[model samples]
Target: MSSSNKQAGSLNEKAGISSPEITNASAISQIKNKRRQQPSAEELISGIISGNRTTLSRAITLIESTNQDHTEKANQVIKGCLSEANKSIRIGITGVPGVGKSTFIEAFGKHLTSLGKKVAVLAVDPSSSLSHGSILGDKTRMEELVKDENAFIRPSASGETLGGVARKTRESIILCEAAGFDVIIIETVGVGQSETAVHSMVDFFLLLKISGAGDELQGIKRGIMEMADAIVINKADGDNIKKANLAKIEFNRALHLFPSKKSTWQPKVTTCSAITKDGISDIWETISQYFELTHETGYFDEKRKEQNQFWMIETINEHLKSDFFNNPKILSQLDETKKAVQNNEISPFAAAQILLDKYKKI
Candidate 1:
């Protein structure tokens, strides 16, 4: 051993202080054998722009993390990505349960990749308030697309966001676009008000349907259909083919009844078989035509701008509500006010005004 090391060890022993168990040689080896340091935010953005899949995945994970440290880092990564200025066709696909949404997405995503488009699928899964977790079953459902090198699939929980989409989905899309994906598909939890939320964000909204059911019309809200750019009927093979065609005709008639969208493009209805892969191209053609017409009319860009504005306002309102209710002073006051209203001491609005006044004071 070196003289200095021997002297240090001797002094430590004399003083009853234990020396570190690691020898200099072991320390050196440890340094040499250490895992590579993690890349910085800029490095991650660079890697993502270069189409590095692992880095892309890491960036997405960072974005999804709820921790404060992760949030700051995720913001940095997302900010760096925004400079790439990648614009993609954002599509929202929604259907009631059993409408083959997953199968259709798998097939549609593969089709986009085949056409030299980098496709990213963001799936919103139902959340359980009791567990605070989601099924996260999109990966399992889209096995084929999961293996495709050109496709990226991220399944996220709805997480108390009544909109049927994960809160960070818009941010996730920004990351994927920066990673160079040209086609982004958002699949909602189901066909409800969630459809309205998805419709607000996407360029083309497609509603998937199935045929030969007693309550086929009951499952799909007419308001949801009005928002759709196209309604696609899945499982259009085997004995279901004739029934699927009949349903398509019925939906076409139903769609004609609604006022035309601002885009001025008539929503098309078609049948597809995610299992058999029938009528896949037709759906693409319909989407392509919608984009072409909307872009030509300038409504496409206008809609996106409106959506951004809406989101900005929505986010601000959400934060205000969250902050007011979560304020330390407000929480206790709210608790008292709730009992007051329950006991007929105050009207509901009066109780709410009390909390708002308290929030303002705080």
Candidate 2:
């Protein structure tokens, strides 16, 4: 032992007091979180399907990787897991900052686990557009849920995506489902396009709002309000109870102004206090009722199929857009086209057509 530690131990011994060893919790946690041993893609697929949480987590990390080989491997893992997907209750939750999303998720996830359900949370944390930095910090907030044996929580950075969701969230959901999670909750990076991106992949979309904020209409846009299957007014306890109820009424009235959805399920509004664990069950009951009604209507399966088709087209569009922009011919002419358009030597449409023709020739 070092002299300082020996002296301290000697003093404790002389005083008949036992000394306890200390641990560096944060350092130990960081060491354990290091990337696991790399295995074959087949191994990863099999491990995930076998319900290995570490392997499942590694598979998600692989999918989130930017490396080309990692991406190819990730695709193989996703392909192997497809048959196991479309079996869970996919719910997307979104609200502005400070709306208690993380707290609600922890409470809600624990509730699900209590009912013998496996819950997976895909939380998107905002990333800096320039430096590509993000804390991916929401996991730290859900200490209890993180320790739950049946729960898996992954915090992803929403880098450069306008929707404020990870680019590979859909693939992550498939991996989670293949790992046998029955409840998949996607928490967005606050409101806006992130909610819509989440809505495209989820079976039900829920918008969380708070009270004493312009009656719950100040921050939320009309389209988002219309897309919400349920609007929850959080912080309903203590002094906020009356305000929460009033906000709930206003939200319900506003939702009534929108046309009915194709699924025939009318949107609803309610209040909840995540801190006190009050009304959490009611919100879940609302989700259960939604699933029951949608399944009975056959809209549930139809929506999933529609989502698949949408993603197929989206993939093609993204691929073609990337290919076109990355073409050397397009790059060579882009500056020329811009100059011509700016100098009035050629119309913008004409310049675009010229570049398109040049790209086609190449």
Candidate 3:
């Protein structure tokens, strides 16, 4: 081979085209800025009150965190925002697993935004029992509402909370209200004890249902029926329309059997289709009528006051339980204590007492 040809084919020879820079200093600087320390309570409060969604999300994340420092900071932010909070209506919606909660919420939330209302949805996604993780896929399900500038959709893991809700959901609502959202919607894991927890936090409790093959009133829980401010039969379109109307009548008749509510507002049964968007506006109108009546009768403010008091006691109980379980001595003995009870070496009550005594001493 010619010497020139050998030189051209050399493996170590520099390429005719040069490669671009591997790192961009400007990009690194931007990333560093993004990774800056958490904001102060005052800064978060200011941003939230000014209607910044990013700041509001960060504040909610802090509230959800279990770290000691984060909890303290979250408390400060909540206190600062408390005055601006409680200015919005909180609505709790729940139903059976296949009751189209995500669909109904999207339709309802979009309707609310169209009427010049800022809506925030706190959806509690069920967590995996084995993995203790959640998909948090509500944002994916509500495609349109999520993209709407005026609508905020936040999905949190149920995380061992009895009511299929995040423990910090109440605090998140306060932040959302302070951020100037006119409407706050809480979607629970399903219809169970979670409904009662959600019911206490919300101004109105809505039970979503769909027509089934069996009797409409058969599987309904009496406590849940009594707690409902409104029973909405969703998916009232196509061939299901007639069945939905029949279910509505059955629910209405059942509701009338309950004692009169303190608010003096009769719980109404209505039907709607989330997919076709039919009867969606009417549902809102019914909700509006509820607000008008409750506000005029002073039941709205009174209910909130009662809820606040109830939550105070609940907060104490939660902290006490957390402290009991988290104590160093209790943590060391809990598993062994459980095993002892399981093996019949000790009564469950006795085992629990032993742990409680140890906790008290600690």
- The prediction achieving the highest lDDT against the true structure is 3
Worst 10 contiguous positions by lDDT, candidate 1: 7-16
Sequence-dependent TM-score of model 1:
0.85
Candidate 2 matches the true fold with a TM-score of 0.85
Best-to-worst order by lDDT is 3, 2, 1
Candidate 1 clashes between residue pairs 3 or more apart in a chain or in different chains: none
RMSD of each: 6.7, 8.2, 7.0
All candidates' lDDT scores?
Answer: 0.85, 0.87, 0.90
Writing each residue's lDDT as its tens digit, candidate 1 over 21-85 gives 66475655455455346668988999988988889888887777755567678878988898874
lDDT of 3 by residue, 165-283 (tens): 78999999999999999999999999477998999999999999999757788767889999999999999999999999989888888889889999999999999999999999998
List TM-scores for all candidates, in order. 0.85, 0.85, 0.92
RMSD of candidate 3 to true structure, Å: 7.0
Runs of candidate 1 exceeding 4 Å displacement: 1-40, 68-70, 332-334, 338-345
Residue pairs clashing in model 2 are none
Descending-TM-score candidate ranking: 3, 1, 2
Error of 1 at 218 (Å): 3.8
Displacement of the residue 36 alpha carbon in candidate 2, Å: 10
Per residue, candidate 2 scores C-alpha lDDT tens digits across 40-104 of 88999899889999899889989988665676788899999989887899999999999999999
